[model samples]
Every structure is written in structure tokens, then in C-alpha cells.
Target chain A: MTAAQGFRHGLRTAIVSVFALVLVGTYVSVGALAHDFGFSASWVAAQTVLIWAAPAQVIMITAMGAGASPLEVAIAVGLSAVRLMPMVVALLPILRTPRTRGWQLVITAHFTAASMWIEALRLAPDVPREARIGFANGLGVAFMSVAVASAVGGYFLAFSLPTALVAALLFLTPSSFLIGAIRNSRRMVDWLALAFGLALAPVLALGAVRLDLLWTGLVGGTAAYLVQRLRGGR
Target chain B: MSVLGDLWPYVVLVLVGFLPNEIWRWLGVVAAHRAGEQSEFLTWARAVATAVLAGVVAKIIFFAPGALASVPLAVRLAATVVAVIAYLLIRRSIFAGVLCGSIALVLGGLVLAP
Candidate 1:
């Protein structure tokens, strides 16, 4: 590549690093979580690669930690993922391009989680429609590679890391996540999502049953949307 | 071959867990073509995703094990809000906010530890 091409490539990578940090960090945390919970390494890697959502992953593992049955954990995790359908609908339009192959689309789609899609939506307007998908894939690829690497590392290193530090790192992704949400929320709906989820999580945590993550997403998300609508958020 | 035999069940279990997520991604590819910025579905997705992230944040902050748990809840919460707000204040830089937040979390833990 030419100097300019190289520089742009580097710049794109640099921008992705901002996002990839948490993604990779989350991988490490999840690795530790899975290992601590006695999950198989391959299972952890597959879900992190495929699922790409930490909360749902955490919920599944945590439920297991709480001795929930495999069927129960599966149901809880599946319910947590119901929200992704909307994310998929909202995000892919920006990335859809004629030249973009279906397989490529499938590969890149692995990276389309909530945070990535939300940011891409803001940037999609400035991008040509056809190239949007390419850009999204390019963005998504960085995280995929990182997740793969961190999973490998975390799976191996899970036994070495101290308990306290692992917990700290696990806590870090969400802190970084909240920071991302508060900063990136351009619309009123965005604000409501941030505040409502933040407020309702602890209450949901107190639930004796499983599915706290899903319940929080449902009740808190609806309330936030309602509150936003009441304030004329549309 | 032996290693493969040992790990086969895990491989399948992993497959089952990820299949649903892959469906979501393929669906994203289709939506990339059909949806628009102002689409109501987009708004709903954004709200749900953001809320989930927030809930995730709440869980990590309050419930995680180890040194972070040793810190006063008030201090940790305050530090998170301050760090995240500072991230926005610094022109929406994720790097800036996260770096500061991580620093604050570690430092706060050290100071608050008994």
C-alpha cells in the first residue's frame, strides 16, 4: 500500500482500538468468568465470537454459577438476545452494499452488537450506501480478531490471574460501556436507554429468579422509551 | 484426533450457543439494506441495547468479586459517573474516558481497601 493508504489503514485501526479495548478486555474477563465457573474453553470462545454481547454471556455463565439448570440458562440467555433483532434491523441498512457478498456479510455480522451498531448509525449518513456495509465489516473485523486472540490468551491464563484483578477487569468493560453510552447518545431515546438501564439493573439484580438481565432490559427499556415519548422524544 | 475426541462435546455445545447469535448477524445484513436512520425499529434497538449496556454496567460495578467490591459503593459509583461524564466532556473520546475510568477504579479500590 502507498503511504496515504498505509496511514489511513493505521488511522482506521487506531479508531478501532478505542472500541476493541473493551471487546478484547471483555474477552479476557469472560475467559476468566468461564474458567472460574468451570466452563469449557471452546464453549467460551465460541459464544464470545458468535454472541458478541457480554451481558448475555455473563448472564448465562452467572446463572450456571448460581446452579441454574442448563435449560434455564439457555432460556435466559436466549431471551437476553431477543433485543438483537431490532439492532440487526436498524444497523444492516447502513452496511448494505451491492458489492458486498453474502458470506462476507455473514462474517462481518458477527461483530454487530449494540454498541457498534449504535455508533455506526451515526456515521452511516456520511457514508455512501454501498460502501456502508464494507465500512461496518471493516469495523467489525477488528473486534473479531481481538476477541479470538483474547479468548485464546484468557483461556490459557485464567489459572494465573488473581481473583481480584479479574473482577476489576470484568467491571471495567461496563464502566467503559456506560461511558460509551453516555457519550454517544445523540437522541432522547438514547438518553432514556442509558438512564433507565442504569437505574433498573440493581432492582433486577434482586430478583430471586433468573433472567434478571432480560427483565431489566425489558422493563427498564420500556420505561425509558415511555419516558422519552412522554417528553416527545420522537 | 485424541484432542478432538476430548473436546467434541464442548465444540457442539459452543455451536449451539452461537447459532442464535449468528442468526442475529445475518438478520443485520438484511437490515443493512432495508432499514433507515429514522426507522422506528432502529430507535427501539438503540434503546434496548443501550439499556442492556447500562444494566451490564450496574452489574459489574456492584456485584463483581475481589478488590473492586472492597471499595465503598458510593465511591465506585461516583467515580464511574465522573469518569464517563469526563469522557463526554473530552469530546466523546472513548479512549479518554475509559483510561480515566480504569485508573479511577484501580485507584479508588486501592484507597478504599481495608
Candidate 2:
């Protein structure tokens, strides 16, 4: 197929991907719940447009709700976003060509959340290089538009929904991520990292220390990496 | 209303929160220009990122704040296990896993509620 057709195909696949829809919907609920937690609706909307990463958005909202100072909230959100670095690193090459413009890369990079990254990594290779960015942008635009609308919808719904349903909505975000991580687990290191992180996160949180997520990630991740290296790679 | 008082903190959070995340994406663009995907640093970074993500997920499941805190630990754990099992059984379909896990959590809550 031609590059234009490939772009259209990628865009269509992304819009129809059930996993993408679920993740986007979960993010919308998260944004709405953040508003419910007392953050201004405008603030949540800005976060959706600007940060555009659901995990970081959730961390920021929860930290703010827990009375963390703005600096603390920022720190936690930043730490939560650390994981996206490798994702971006892994995805940029797949989406870029020798002639791809810098601005195009920048824009697409901004849209590279886990959902997009996973899709792009899987699908971009088959698409013509010239059209990869367009495909990604199409997916990004569609997902973000729906996600923003959902956030607004959830914001209105939050005021009317029962507490139990609201709580379940909140649970959807993390549970989805947990399942995503499990689904993404392919290598021995992936499993080890998850196990180590799962074991360490609660301990750190209960310790009442600052930057608990950051520390848990650093220690758990480093240990997993070392173990994998010691086990002689892969 | 004191607009500054109401807004400045969030503005600060946005700026600070955005930088750390964006910096990585920017770096990724640069690195993708220079290094092959198989570079050791990228591999290590991927491992670290995966672990960090897992840690965050763990925090949410085990030490969830607010309403989720009310659910029993056993229920949450059970739901997660079932979700993973469902994902595996369904050929790693994320939607199925999430749906199964969510239903499990709700059912677990109903059954285990006291």
C-alpha cells in the first residue's frame, strides 16, 4: 500500500483498538476524579492537554489531594514520568525517518504515551516511513480528543454518581496499568523488575519517606537490571 | 478572588511536572538520531522504566488512598491475579484482562464485604 493508505490504515487501527479505548477512558475518569478531589476543572483539563500522561496525571492529582506541597506533587509526577523516557527512546526511531523534520518529531514525541508507543512499536514498521508520523498524530489526536471529552464528561458525572461507582472508576486507572504491565512483560528482567517493584513499593510508602515512588523505582529497577545482567543477558 | 493564590501553585506543578517527563522524550529524539535501538543504555533504561511503572502500579493496588482503600487487600490481590490469568488465557488481550480484573474486584468486594 502507498504511504497515504498506510497512514490511514494505522489511524483506523488505533481508533478501533479496544485497548486504546479502554486506556483513554480510564485516563478520562482519572481526570474527572481529580476534579472531584477538589482540583479546579480547568487545572485538570490543562493537565490533560499539557502533561498528557495518565500515570503522571494520577500521581499529581493524588499527591495534591494528600496535601503534598506543589513541589512535592511535581516531584512525584516527574518520578512517575521517568518510565516514559525509555518508551520514547524505544519508539522515536520506529516513527522517524532520515528526512523527518525536527518539529514533527517533537510533536509526535509529545504524544507518545504507553498506548501510542505500544501501537507504534508494533505497527509503524510496516507503514511507509513518510507516513508514520501522520499515523501517530492521527491516533494521538483522536485519543486525546476522546480522552478530554471523557474527562469533561466524568467531571460532570462525578457530581452525580454514587460513591461506589466513582470509587470503581478510580480503580480502573491503576488496574488497567497493572494489567498493561503484566501484558507487556516478555523477558526475564521484565518479570523480575515487576516482582521487585511490587515488593518494594509498599515498604517505601509505609516508611513515610519523601519521594517514595522515586526511591522504590530506583532500587527495584537497579536490582532487577543487575540481576538480569548477572544472569547473562536477556 | 486572589487569582494568584488560587492558580500559582497549580501552574508551578504543571511546569515542574512537565519538564521531567518532556526532557526524556526530547532526549529520546536525540538518542534515536544517534544510537541504535539495541544500545545497552537503552536496554537498561527500559528495564528501569518497566520497574518504575510496576512500582507505581503496586502502590496503587496495595496502598490505594481514598475509596479504594476500603477494599480488602485480599480482594485486590485476588482480582489482580485473576486479571493476569485472564490476560494470559485470552492471548494477552488487555481489554479482556482489565474487564475481568475489574469485575473480579467488584465481585470480590461484594462477596467479601462485612
Best by DockQ: 1
lDDT of each: 0.67, 0.72
* DockQ of each model vs. true complex: 0.55, 0.54
lDDT of 1 by residue, A1-234 (tens): 332343344337535656677766667767777888877787777767667776678777788778876677666666767667656665665556556577766655676775566556656556556556556665665566677678767877866876446545655677766766776677787887788888788777876547676677777777777777788857
RMSD of each: 4.1, 3.5
- Please estimate how well model 2 matches the true structure, expressed as its whole-model Cα lDDT: 0.72
Candidate 2 RMSD to the correct structure: 3.5
> Chain A in model 2: its TM-score?
0.76
Single-chain TM-score of chain A, each candidate? 0.74, 0.76
* Candidate 1 C-alpha error for residue B93, in Å: 2.1
**Which regions of candidate 2 fall more than 4 Å away from where they truly are?**
A1-7, A37-43, A58-76, A125-130, B1-21, B31-33
User: Candidate 1, residues B1-114: lDDT per residue as tens digits?
Assistant: 999997874654454456544565566566655556667666666677678778878886777544457666766776787677778788778778777777776677677765
